[model samples]
Target: MVYRLLKYVVLGPLLRLLWPTKVTGTENIPAEGGAIIASNHLAVADSFFMPVYVPRRVTFPAKQEYFTTPGLKGRLQKWFFTASGQFPIDRSGASAAQAALDTGVRLLAEGRLLGIYPEGTRSPDGRLYKGKTGVARIALEAQVPVIPVAMIGTDRVNPIGSKMWWPRRLEIRFGEPLDFSRYAGLAGDRFVERSIADEIMYALMELSGQEYVDVYAAKAKEELGEAVPLHGRAGEVGAARAGTAPSRVPESRAG
Candidate 1:
């Protein structure tokens, strides 16, 4: 009820009117089923705009801090996230990634739509990054189809570190569902899992029309952050690899 109220009566109308979003290929979404919607993480708005356009409720794994913080401000934030279709997940501890993967699989097993960013974080420079294999693991474990969705121009609407949204054109494109039933029992095989993740990223690249970066976005951002203070601002660096590239070889072309 809260999610519906916010999506239709509250934030949905306001966001659509302000951003002027255009969604395409929504028919690719299954009417009802356990599925994973793998999207290219461009901005925080990607989460907001996606659920507003889709017919079904989308649940994302948000860091626990978003719901557990103290004070009135924290309570408001918690309410908004829950209303916007997000659930808290603890991201601490050595097994955090695996724990999150298990949570996603559980949601899928229960016949819910799960939204995940394969890149694990927002693109540092709007280029698609190499995807983490957790998405593949979840799909295999839950035996669900993975749908690739692309969010275009959301960066302008909600840029990194920006306090206010700048009205801009937005688009969400959905691609055909990817079937990994062939790899059903091979969930824990690292090589097979990486292959699945690479395929998913390749699909995202075609749908999103963005250049594929073979490096992880978080590492790329860390390198950018470290170099920006000394040489120039982040924009000037523009996804500086800073020697993080070429360390690991990719098994497949993510593009």
Candidate 2:
């Protein structure tokens, strides 16, 4: 299969040789069965390095644009994404978030490992940001555990707005799987969902040892610009002044 060929023969070996990644707490990953790997997105390479380091095949929902380009390069991009276990996600319309949640639920129901960046977008300044509740909704709906993964030093490999990649030693630490069965049927409760998302983000913060920002990463990028302040409190106040609140689960029904 193309997946195996790419992982074992081509990309995998190349990544290992270039980055020489060090992974710890991998035993936290289930040998088999469905689970969610919730990670703090640091750089574009986070996605690439994650699948390369994780033993099991991990799939993440990618924007449809990654598959819809109109040339030979686009075709190669589509092939690479597919072989790497990524699937196209149409993130448009009012139900875009729900659509992604539905896809994640389906993947988990089929016993596949789903990779999610709870922050929804990469941190503009390498700090942990508030997580969206969609991750909690999918985990509860699929009745699976959420594993916290932290990718360290990936930002140096591929920083924001940079097309070139630099070889750097990357560290991936997998935390113990978080079980939220206590809120099993309460996915509809906004408070409970926020709590679940907060819990996951907290775990990521501890694992990654990055400063935690209460506002969403995209908002921080937009309002605070790429040079996010080093002080967490200042950034939070600026985001608050900019009218950015913590992310919540979409009210739309998970299809």
Candidate 3:
């Protein structure tokens, strides 16, 4: 397929040459069969860097807008996303999130690897945020092991508020897959769901060594001045108060 050709035969070789990435624990990923890669999202480049390093074809859902632009650039962007094996999902609310989770389950059911950032969005300050329960739900539903990935030094490669990529060292550490099979039947129970989610976030925290925020990624984004767009999604702001949202560390602690 186009994705394999682009990655192994074309772009992968070029990116490896240009960035010279160091990928540790490649063996942590199963050589074949299905799996889910739950990574800490730090930078825009996280999307691009992780897939090239994993031998299996890893498909993740990207925002729908990325494929909806206009003109030549739009066409090129669509092509790239298609080649990268990303499908579009509206990042609006529980419905879209559930739909995305369903998509992930379908992929796993068919024996494909699916990548997800349980934080839901990029970490603004590189600290691991509380993971949403969707990740636990998927693992339970699909009966797949979750691979905890720690991405270091990607933020420097393409920092926020910047459009260019700078030459930087990239380190990708893949921790052993975390299994929650013991809680097999409780995946749908809210209490068990939350416990499993917390477990995954803690694993990511231990691997990344970034300050842990007990809040969701989008809320942290708002606090960091990257508020949701005026005409964009509705739940990003007010929904913070809807659920028993996780607590956040003081800014000083995060710094």
Candidate 4:
């Protein structure tokens, strides 16, 4: 309906002419069936380019505020996001994260392509950040494949806090599906979840060529605050390997 209209008749065509993305590895996407496209969140543009290029419609768990805000502008936003296939999930309270995971699992059960940002939010400084384990939980619980996606050079088109987008050559790369069937029944195990999350992040690092930071993007934003610019700053730490989460990260899935 609206999703098709926007992707084909309206927004999609405009994006193609304006940005002209160099997307590759789309063949990696499964021809049919439920899967998770776990991506590195570089900018808001990452959200647009990732789904528009993929063949299937993508459903994402947008923040509740995007739907619940007041005024006419908010109403249009709610309509647009809903029409574009986004659903609202409360990102507050203790169970907030779980709610999102549950929603993702439900979508997967319905055989929809669920797009998730393992880092939870956009990269505050263009470097990959520590990923939350929710993506692992969703993949294992739903028993589906997780494909790692990387959006490159998007920051140049629309940097954080910038009100405008400019035409820039951007690349979107997709890696082969990451199978976690080896740890099938261990979904709730904290170590297994963290291990899986780290593995996905590792794939993004390789595909995106961005440095990896041990800190979460939200925390990094708070810690650095106004002192650091939102884009172009180097990662505070070098690449963190699949099994090498920082001290705060739980132990690996190994016995």
Distance from true location, Cα of 228 in model 4, Å: 3.9
Steric collisions counted per model: 0, 0, 0, 0
Output the worst ten-in-a-row residue range by lDDT, candidate 2. 241-250
Better model by lDDT: candidate 2 vs candidate 3: 2
Q: How big is the positional error of residue 189 in model 1, measured in Å on the Cα after superposition?
A: 0.5
Tens digit of lDDT per residue, candidate 2, span 101-145?
889999999889999999888887777788888898998899899
For residue 44, model 3's alpha carbon misses the true position, in angstroms, by 1.1
Model 4 lDDT per residue over 134-213, tens place: 89899999999999999998988988778899789989999999888888889898878888888898888889887778
TM-score quality measure for candidate 1:
0.89
Q: Candidate 3 on 134-236: residue-level lDDT in tens? A: 8889998998898989999888887776789889988888989977777676657786677767777777777777667667778767755654332244334
Q: Which residue pairs show collisions in model 4? A: none
> How do all the candidates rank in terms of TM-score, highest first?
4, 1, 2, 3
lDDT of 1 by residue, 1-255 (tens): 999999899988898888887799899999998999999998888888899899999999998999999999999999999878798877777588778888899999888999999998888777788899889899999999999999999988877777688989888999999988877788898987888888888888888888777788887788676224322443433345422221222435222
lDDT of each: 0.83, 0.83, 0.80, 0.84
Q: Give the Å shift of residue 149 in candidate 4.
A: 0.4
Report the candidate with higher TM-score, 1 versus 3.
1
Error of 3 at 131 (Å): 0.8
